[model samples]
Target: MKCKILPPKVLYHPVLPYKQLTSDNTHKLLFGLCRTCMNKISFKCKHIDDPTLNKHDKIHEIKRCKECKNIKNEKCIHSNEERVIVGTWSTIEIDKAIEKGYKLQKIYELEHFEKTSTDIFKLYVDTFMKYKQEASGCKCDPKYCKPDCENDKECKTKIQYIIDNAAYNLDIDKVKHNSGLRFIAKICLNNLWGHFGMRDNFTQKEYCFTLEHITKIVFNEKYKDISTMILDENIVLTEYKEKEEYSKPNPSVNVYIALFTTAHARLKLYELLDILQERVLYMDTDSCIYNDDGSEACKK
Candidate 1:
């Protein structure tokens, strides 16, 4: 969406203060957090080039092999367009944990772990709690959060009331259970980082290309080096190249910051899932599929 220059009497600072995130630091921080205390972990890959050849080359990334362990550090050194193979594990329940389960352990192990801040999602409950705190006067900035609850009086009052009265927050502080706040927080979390929507100021060609090609560019730049995945259809590179009307770089829409938030959100999901001791099957950016009876205890 494009911002219009309103006459000065309208809302000042309608947008939140922007924060910057360096890609390298974010990669290390997020991967580090996800690697701690993982149980039932395993890894399996058919091929690796060699670990000692290149420090930045992750082609030889191997986790369980003692000889391959030295070069796994590159997994945390991502560029703006680098792809990371993030490994996640499920903390199974007592019944599932004793099933004599066996799995491999060839993961590209993490280098370190770091503490997360309030601006991130630590499951729905923590996000709801943070939202409540923000509504009641906690920090609200792009560095850690995007909710406008701190600024809107009505929204603030409503969330605080929910926090004060809700039993879900009292249920040993788990987000896997049910509550109105958790429901709303889950919705907010799912849609927190929408696509970098198009700007209205673009010409027709630029608009079309932005929608059709920008995602392709980023995806290809990240995955082009990895040979294991098959590229069935070649992307037509020059299909849309129009002479463009140049606009100044908008500092607020930096992709790196968006990527950083997404990484933390991912860590938040893993943290929430592993803590709840559920059988985590799979996870996308905003969703996870785990073994549950579809009750309040199963939802995350």
Candidate 2:
């Protein structure tokens, strides 16, 4: 008998669709799938028709298939509507200030406080000090002293002269003074009331006169007369009117008065209306159209 020799077995590699399987009894097989293309692949082992093939010979493991790696390269876009939102709330410091008896000043303070770092108490202190200095007429400086006064007639004479001048100038009798303290007090009170939305009923003339009086008292000086304060003839009242025709009525007459009054007049008008509304509704429960039950109530 002649000895038989087996020829080298040919290896076959097959590619299939994803999830496909291959079965062949003639060859040992190994399987793998590409992550990129998700394609199934099989490798045939050279040991064909061998019943005792090694278990490790049929195993193939991939850490990450090529398909998954490609997914990592693509960028993900998110909708703008789904983006995070940021918001802010008003600070409560002003509310606290109002609760602490600053209701009057709080109005203007709230209006202008954010624009400036200074507080209401600081403004009060400064105004008080300024008015005090103006009232006292003192230079706010210490008086100069003389040394070796016994032998110097010139020094003595100078000292006497200074004393006379100081006495005459500082005396209430010789110095013409206005009511500064009262004026400042009035200004502070008016400003506070105005901030609190109080209404003024004074006519334009009366209002201007009151303001001018307060100003004169505070600064101890006279301002221009109200007549002079009015617009001069050089400023044309109405250009649209013909030379032969009477001037058209100026709608800005009252507007100019209100402006000169520094908007306090208009604010006062609103405040008066508010007061009237409150007074008219006082003790009349049925006057409120919207009731607590969310139904319209009979007007009283």
Candidate with top lDDT is 1
Cα lDDT tens digits for candidate 1, 140-258:
34355334443456544544565676643432122122345545655575454443322323322212234356455434432322112222354222223222344444443534335
lDDT (10s digit) by residue, model 2, range 68-182? 3444343323222221111111123222222332222112111113443335446664555445333433222124322233234554454445436552223322221235663
Query: Residue 166 of model 1: what lDDT?
Result: 61
Top TM-score prediction, candidate number: 1
**Against the hidden reference, what TM-scores do the models get?**
0.25, 0.15
lDDT of 2 at 221: 28
What shift in Å separates residue 173 of candidate 2 from its native position after superposition? Answer: 15
* Residue pair clashes in candidate 1: 42-104, 43-104, 43-106, 119-144
Candidate 2: regions farther than 4 A off: 1-129, 136-189, 192-196, 199-300
lDDT of each: 0.37, 0.31
Error of 1 at 271 (Å): 0.5
